[model samples]
Target: MTVILEATERRILQNPLENPEVLIRIVDDNQATCKSLQFFLEALGYEVRIWNDPELFLKEYKENEEDGCLLLDIRMPRISGLELHDILIKENFRLPIIFLTGHGDVEMAVDSVKKGAFNFLLKPSNEKKLTETIEAAVKLSIENHLKENNKTIYREVFDSLTPREKEVVRLVAQGKLNKVIAADLNITEKTVQQHRSVACHKLSVRNVAELVEFLKVLEG
Candidate 1:
């Protein structure tokens, strides 16, 4: 229900490009618990935002530009944490999620993890465990963000290639030699080689191995 910014004034003044922001969003119905966590996590230097209403959080939460993670309570009034997690998954939300579960909710929490929630924290969690889990989730969020960004860049570059260039790249990815590709396309081997060179240059790939790896990532 509250967004706490307890970071020092000096920390706030620093260039975000140099010190990227790390956000921790908490969605729990209990106001007291939310405030307690907000104070604790903010002291640890995270930008914390809490919500008492699951529906409100769902309505307001968008894909974050900064590296971050979500701390969600397992049991709530309207939308349970598991249900929210499902919706996020269906929407392709990639922020790492750490579920806050009560003793009776442990089994459900485990199931949520299997379905792609990052991890779960038991209620009344110890400070050390909570901090460690949040740190790991933030790290993962950063890595995932970087990978998605790279994929976007790769897709843009790939789309820029001509149809013939794309066909040549696909053949090369299938381990075809220039002569074999030429025969398949009914083109000269020299023309096939030219397409290969152009594709590699456009993709910024130095060799076949690199090109293959790039294609693998793009396909994945």
Candidate 2:
């Protein structure tokens, strides 16, 4: 199917704010379809990268580094798109994934969506809908990337705490009072207060609720 974009339509989809620091990664065994999607997306000013083989795509893909949503064909040679999505999930990849599927593969696409795929585009997708979906997916990919980066920084800060501070943070996050923590760790309340104060400063949290939220984000 030929995809035509009117000048106004192009303008609507070509907002720079919507253009994130992300490329469109396309993995499809069908050369013609790949070329069509690439052309359509690139015409709308998106940076696109294509791979004809799922294995090659997997080898090249890195979590949070490549930083883009995936456009994958649901049925492929060795590793199916669903299988690839599973592998990415197992490896803790948080980028949005958009699957390309035929009518027969709708069930698999639905299953992938349930497993956190961004969305699936039917073969011979509508030009308007495809571009809109890709834009939304790119925005989501950027948000996910920011979240993963934030998590990394938080984990680093959490790791920088001394063992004693770590214990204090753990107990505090578990809703233990400083006196209870001191008793549990066989320390005076004054020592526990000192440790807790330092931990709070290091973690940059003013209160126990904030510290617990940080811990939750770090763990996630």
User: All models: lDDT?
Assistant: 0.80, 0.79
Cα-based lDDT at residue 203, candidate 2: 84
Enumerate residue pairs that collide in model 2.
none
Tens-digit lDDT track of model 1 for 22-42: 788999999989999999998
What residue pairs clash in candidate 1, if any at all?
A: 1-50
Candidate 2, 1-220: lDDT as tens digits: 0012124324433453454566888888999988988888889878888899989877887632655578888789999888888998998776788887774366776787899988978877888888878878876666566566667878888898999999999999999988999999999999999999999898888888888888887888
TM-score for predicted model 2 compared with the true structure: 0.73
Give the per-residue Cα lDDT of candidate 2 at 141: 65
TM-score of 1: 0.82
